[model samples]
Target: MAATPNIYGILAEFETPADAMHAAEKVRDTGFRKWDVFTPYPVHGMDKAMGLKNSKVGWFSFIGGVTGYTSGMVMIWWMNAVDYPIPIGGKPMFSPFGAFPPCYELTILLGAFGALFGMLFMNRLPRLHHPLLKHRRFALATHDRYFIVIETTDPKYSENETRKLLESVGSKRIELVEE
Candidate 1:
């Protein structure tokens, strides 16, 4: 017998955002974690349905901001006090008040960079292609369809059972996505 084809996942198409959201809740309750939902437009409460937690991007930004501020302050102090020992009209060479503007600017710059890079990293973006992109009907996802995909990598995934689950959850159409 020939070997079975490798598959990326099972794709279920829903007629409406509510149907997709409800199916997501079912999928979550069924304990299948390796899944994603795609919609033509944003759906409120979808994150809760997908069981996702708060993002760590903010933490990345905070760390970047702190590093920038510390580095800015240290560089200013080292240049003014340790390196040149500048004495300007009896003013302290390394006063923090004098360094606040540059420090704040650096903090904002690095924090913005952190947020941008962190978002891209977290989303695994810059991808050129995905298996789902080959699905003929998937192009409609940007117009009017909503899709839910459950990857075969999920521990709970079984072809027959996943198909049945999607059917029971009111999927209008279901198609297998090959890798």
Candidate 2:
């Protein structure tokens, strides 16, 4: 008996951005969660067609910025007022105006870090390998072609049905990608 190959997904290639966008819409309508689209350039309205929501990176950045600002203020207060009282020129020991510069700088720094880390986490990036990377046709995605990959792990995936769906969407080429 022959061992069955591990199927990764179904890959559909499109001739143009419009075709790929339309295919994405159909896939989205079919309610497949484990799917993604690739294109040579950014496709306007692709997010909507894919039913994607706003990124969570902004929330991460906001939280980081708030934490940074608060920590900066607290650190300055601790050092100036609590740890050692330096009464210079009758100036207040702890002042918001004085802390604003360092607080603002920390806020920017932490916010940027949050955005970078958040993006990497959300994308599951730094991946060492992917089945699609080995596919010869997939490389064209960076050059001229657009491709849509519907993972077999998706709840709605049915080999026959998914292939038919791709055909209906006018895919130029369809292949079963294996792991």
Candidate 3:
């Protein structure tokens, strides 16, 4: 339950993002599904190069923002106009303008929350471990290395075949990332 996935395939490290990108695309071209790449910084055009889909988190953020706006507006309106019927400074019972600040803040809060949760859900995060973490050199990934993980779930994944595949794709240094 703690370990996220039984990553039993192979891992290949790259000295640069370009190499990682190249290897990832070639690996994908060969029909490998259970694979992911790690990078220290966002690499320009990496998404397209890796054949990744646009994130759906935007939709979640949109919905969350709408919800937050609605919640803030309704709460303020009800409290001032209908719930308590308080009349302050001769202003209108429901001050739509007054609600703007809180509504905006709420929208941002909700949007951030939605994005965070959406990412976690999309990525299946919060697990205790990953296969890449087991690799001794994988620690360098966060510092200066780019890495690709090919998991065992892929039909094309086999120790020998995966090794050959990585080697064929011009992997700089191949290592078995364990978990």
Model number with the top lDDT: 2
lDDT of 3 by residue, 1-179 (tens): 57664546577888888888888889878887778888998999888878888899998899989999999999999888988997889989988798899999999999999999988988899999865677788898789988888887788888898898888878878876544
lDDT of each: 0.94, 0.95, 0.84
Which ten contiguous residues of candidate 2 have the minimum total lDDT? 117-126
The TM-scores of all predictions, comma-separated, are 0.93, 0.96, 0.85
List the candidate numbers ranked by lDDT, top first: 2, 1, 3
Specify the highest-TM-score model's number: 2
Better of 1 and 2 by lDDT: 2
lDDT-superior candidate, 1 or 3 = 1
Q: What lDDT does candidate 2 reach at residue 172?
A: 69
State model 2's lDDT.
0.95
What digit string (tens of lDDT, one per residue) describes model 2 on residues 101-138? 99999999999988998889898987999999999989
Off by over 4 Å in 1: 1-4
Model 3 poorest ten-residue lDDT run: 1-10
Ranking under TM-score, best-scoring first?
A: 2, 1, 3
Q: At residue 171, what lDDT does model 3 achieve?
A: 83
